[model samples]
Target: MEPSSATVAAYSPCGSTAAVCRAVAEGTGLAWDERDLARGTRPEPVDPGTLVVLGAPVAGGAVPALGLERLGRVHTAFSPCVLVCAYGDRDPGHGLHDLEAIAPGLGLVPVAAVLAPVRHVMVPALGAGRPTADDLAAYRSFGAAVASALRDAGGLFDLAPPPLPPASCPRERLELGFTAECDPAACVGCGACAGACPAGCIPADEPYLTDTARCDGCMACIGVCPVRARSLSDPARLAAVRERCVAGWEGPHRPRLVMGA
Candidate 1:
């Protein structure tokens, strides 16, 4: 089957990376299906003839572990895949290359990759006021170009990228160790927290309990709680990390886009 359709499979906790997927989908100049994994969305394998626009944010200089896990669940090899990684002003390190390294094995034919800039999720001060008009414009154009390329290729496009940098982000496995709790006083048994959880770390039956061991402390539950029942047991850790990041951070990162080789 010839490739003509597009799908966006993204893991965005704070919405920045999701926006990149939107720009890329629109760029494909094709009606695209959105799989916003953060909002508890799951996608089925496609026809292998569609375009897979895979995207995620950087966590500790690599694609968020949960995102990477989720990426493995989706089907892509049969499709031409375009990658987009969103990161703070600081370097995204080997996150994009990490994704590239696995593309072919997943049955995805690599075509293009985009590295987008967004305000720092942890230390907003570092990449302040980003994904500005200029950034969004560039994202849209890049998406369009990739879409056009795939459509023109008629499923024949493939690019085998060089081996990615062996060095990963120094804190590739960095964990914030933050804890989340549901205040029974405030929680009304709403399933919002469980539903919004990307990792399904929240139990639907209880709906108030969090498996911190599995939770990455992305704070999705805290943000989506109806009564604001979810609270962080440890906020100081993130605050401290933010302070340190701002102390030595420098940026206003630039977007990196590459066409299929």
Candidate 2:
């Protein structure tokens, strides 16, 4: 059955995944209902006839558990849905695969999956200024293709799930354990970083300090710091990721799209 509208949900702290998800939604040629999980809002119930687009940034060689947890809040029954995972140049990992694995249990019928490449939060130089004009255009095209597939299918079950992207980088090598460190002196007491943190590790009372144990190291706090006070606490881990970025993801990489059959 053809969908009436689309709901786009993404847990993007640094904004890359959100940007990509928006572009894809625009390409679907449907009115969009947006849910930015960064705001700590619960996902609304998905209409059975509404197409759903869910996405998250890859962290620690996979999609962060928080992202998956937020997705679980969405209730749907046989709704056609698209899954996406944005990763730094290192590896796509099992993010897309894992999302697909949970789709059935969530009452979602997986229709397509996208593995997008974006600027690395930890190593900005890697995939820097990425998801360029060309990449976004490609993503839009992928979305249109998904729309076309839905239009032609008889029902959600008639369309086959998109093929999963193959994992490249070894999981062991992708674990760069570094939490954001805020410089107390440079902090101006603005709570932008605290609000931007998807992991909710930043306390509102003391925005400058992050709970490292719960921090996903998504770089959201660092990105939102107006004074540029936040930084990765582990220099050694930073260096290691930088080295890997240069060796593995130096040049431009196109997003991988698997359109539903």
Q: lDDT: which candidate is best?
A: 2
- For model 2, the superposed segments whose C-alpha errors exceed 4 Å read 169-174
RMSD values for the candidates in order, in angstroms, are 3.2, 1.8
TM-score winner: 2
Q: Give per-residue CA lDDT, model 2, range 236-255, as digits (tens).
A: 76788678768775456778
Off by over 4 Å in 1: 39-43, 128-130, 151-171, 183-189, 204-207, 226-231
lDDT of each: 0.75, 0.82
Q: What TM-score does structure 1 among the candidates reach?
A: 0.83
Tens digit per residue, CA lDDT, model 1, 1-261: 335678888878877888887887887678789877666445557667678887888876778777877777677556787777888878787778767866776687767888888887666687787788788888889887776665565445444442333444664556556667787777888788897788788888898788888877666787678688887776677688888888887676688788854
Judged by lDDT against the true structure, how good is candidate 2?
A: 0.82
